[model samples]
Target: MNPASPIRIQGIHYTLPEKQVGLEQLSAEGRLLSTPETMRDFGFGDCRVSSVPATVLASATVKALLERHGVEPGEVGLLINASVLPTSSLVPRGEALAEFPSGESAHLGLFRFSSTRIQDELGLINARTVGLSELGCVSLSHAVWLAHAVMLMEDLKYAVCVNADVFPDGIKREVVYNVCSDSACAVLLSRNPEGMHLKRYHTLTRGYYWDPDGHQNELLAAYFPTGKRVLEKTFKESGLAREDIKLLVPHNVSLRSWEILSRFTGIPLEKIYTENIRPKGHSVAADNWINLKDVIDRGLVSKGDHVMMFSFGLGAHWGCSIVQV
Candidate 1:
């Protein structure tokens, strides 16, 4: 994609659940597999727990993005749901595991499509809906790339990429030493060359590590090297050096891991935006987008500055994108 006419981010909006649970509370309730001390050492202070369903959060995010940017719902030409968890599996966090099997039949769950529901509820009549999964934390990055490609091919003017995920009831919030949170983010992409410009992006998936539980150790071993490779490729393709990147918008995972990655990629640790790590925790694919929005909102980067976003997904996926603001 040409940088001159790149896919621009018009607006970004993210919604977190009202309830905030501290690490100690989750540990006490047995909802977190790791100890509270371990999680706190890993840089997680608290995470948001959704009392409502994921679909409601997703819809509200998209609606807020449109309203904040003064864009009508009818003007959105593409809508991509990039949630890590399937819509069928995303029920209210407060619901019990046993009640889920009896409350909603398999048929009903199978037909619960978040993309279409958001479109219908938000009145995105002209938007083409698509749902993406399996990429795990990289799902939203893939959605952004897909939206950009589809818009260029179809001559669409506006595209909305929304991602939302919640841990099913009775499931542990700790994953590979990182705390998880329930949240949704919506990013509006336009062809009018405004906001952040999508300069270059790269993604890699290693199917050999598909079984997260079975290959947890191996996945952890490969995370840093694979993530470094993706970041290097993104910088190389964007024709910029690590020093040129004004900010590194990262997925809200372990701050220690990011510190190691910064050393591996030769990017200074101070360049990374880590303010959200403790407060927001990891909201799956929504982390990078949420952080990016906050970075822009706080004036962390000036116009024409290069920003790099990177994330490692549980399904053994590595994704990196360099954008110009």
Candidate 2:
């Protein structure tokens, strides 16, 4: 198994919560830790709040993707789950996880076994499930990388990588300068030699800033230098130049942060897709892959496009992926 061999991106699908909650609404609902005006100052807007369990959304999206692509659950050899909430957020399709504060305390008991439950829900019985966490927002991109590695090393035929989560309370919504959205993204990777390829991936973690709040200033200070390093290193590994990238498919962070990163990395702002930020807010698990789906769905990339996806997690982890599509 050659390291450079292609692991085709077979499909990418995601599900957003049905109900949209405005920034002002959170304050009115008594869910915001800060004032509405304070949240709005960061470019926060309407983000989805699902009345249903996170697992229902994730499983439904995965099922539809498999069916539409004529893929069977049994054929999926690996299930790499990138969801890392503190509790089990999956519930009935129409029931809001946010409505249950009592059940949340019980989620801790079931948290370790969430991947098995998600596997059963999606009927991916043949899939050997693997969980990823502690990377915060970069977990999904790392899941994609793991999909590639597992397929190459273990000779797996297919992997379904899912990144999904929605907060049970509006109080859990905001992360620094970004508003968190509830959503899930499912991406399929197949052992194909000539499809969208995961060309290069680089992940780095600074454990010192593990406490995001205590080190807010430090996190802000290190962000630009760290992002530039990760992006450049990933590009170098992929045998591409930063300026040659077709697009910067970001993890739907704030536009201001994206602007800073664009100048720091020398990738034009126009090449970065930010249209989804307003409607999509930031889903820690789903951002990069969801943005990738939006880009491909909107016909923004050609077959040979060189795209870069980068993400930062609160636990001081930065991960980026360079792909050939």
Candidate 3:
């Protein structure tokens, strides 16, 4: 595999749960720690809630992507699960201690890997399964970068990166005033250069803000500056100027935050895709991919058009990736 050969995104698909919950309802149900007015001010209207397990949503997206692209199960050489939540946990962490006094259930939960389950269910017998976590919302970006590297090294045919996340029942849906939705997204990468071409990626991890809950204000303070630096570095690596970016595939955080970032980075706010912010809210690692897919579907971009993807994981990881459509 030549290093110069581009790894392309052959296809992308995402699935959200059928249930949609509004901010008012979430606050009324105590699922939100913030007031409904605050969330609305942040540009959040409604978010999808999942009635099924995270793995089920993940598998659904992958299955849909493969079927839509006519990709065979045996053709996928790598399966990467980038979901932030536990896929196979039989019980919540709080209940595990009480239900399994001997810790047998805990051990079983650890052994029940979500990646393998998706592989088995999808009959991806030739694919090697890997799970990535702790990067928070940046997990999917890292997973895609890993797949690109591994596929190049192993000379693999196809790699599938899947990410799904859902807040547990009775858990808070609001995180620092941003509402979250349950969603799963799958991106198919191949040597075939028919889709978006993978260009360059940059990631920065600030270990000092490792404790997200403890340092919420500090994390918010560092987001824009760190994100600007990341975007500049990513564009420099891609050999493209900021003006070359046709669109900014942003993570569904907040419209106001994106406006601030756009102003700071000298990228116009119109270049950032924000249509999904109010309707879909944020879906952790799946936001960028989902937005990218929609952008392409709407014919907002053309062949050879460059798009920049950026996200800040709550674990203090900042990532930026550039791709050409």
The TM-score measured for candidate 1 stands at 0.94
Cα lDDT of model 2 by residue, 1-325, tens digit: 2346767888898888878889888767876667777666655678888766666677778887788778878989998777757443433323446333345565554453556777887788899987776778987888888888888788888888887786775455777778888888889888666558877788899999999889999889999999998888887777788677888899877777898998998888999988888877887778888888889888998888989888898888898888878
Report the C-alpha lDDT of model 1 over 1-325, residue by residue, as the tens digit: 6666656887789999978999989888788887899889888999999876777788998999999888999999999998787642334333532123335475565655778989999999999999888889998889998999998889888999999887776778888899999998988999666577888888899998899999988888888888888888887788889778899999999998988988887788899999899999999999999998899889998889988999889878988998888
**lDDT of each residue in 1-325, candidate 3, tens digit only:** 1337667888899998888999989998998887888888888899999877777788889999999999999999999999775542223344321122236565665666668989999999999999888888898989999999999889899999999886777778887678999999999999887877778879999998889889988988888889999999988888899889999999999887998998999999988999999999999889999999999999999888999999988878999998888
Model 3 TM-score relative to the real fold: 0.94
Clashing pairs in 3: none
Judged by whole-model lDDT over C-alpha atoms, candidate 1 comes out at: 0.85
In model 1, the Cα lDDT at residue 131 comes to 85
> Please, what is the whole-model Cα lDDT of each candidate in the order they appear?
0.85, 0.79, 0.85
Write down the lDDT that model 3 would get. 0.85
Clashes of each: 0, 4, 0
Residue 152 in candidate 2, Cα distance off native in Å: 1.2
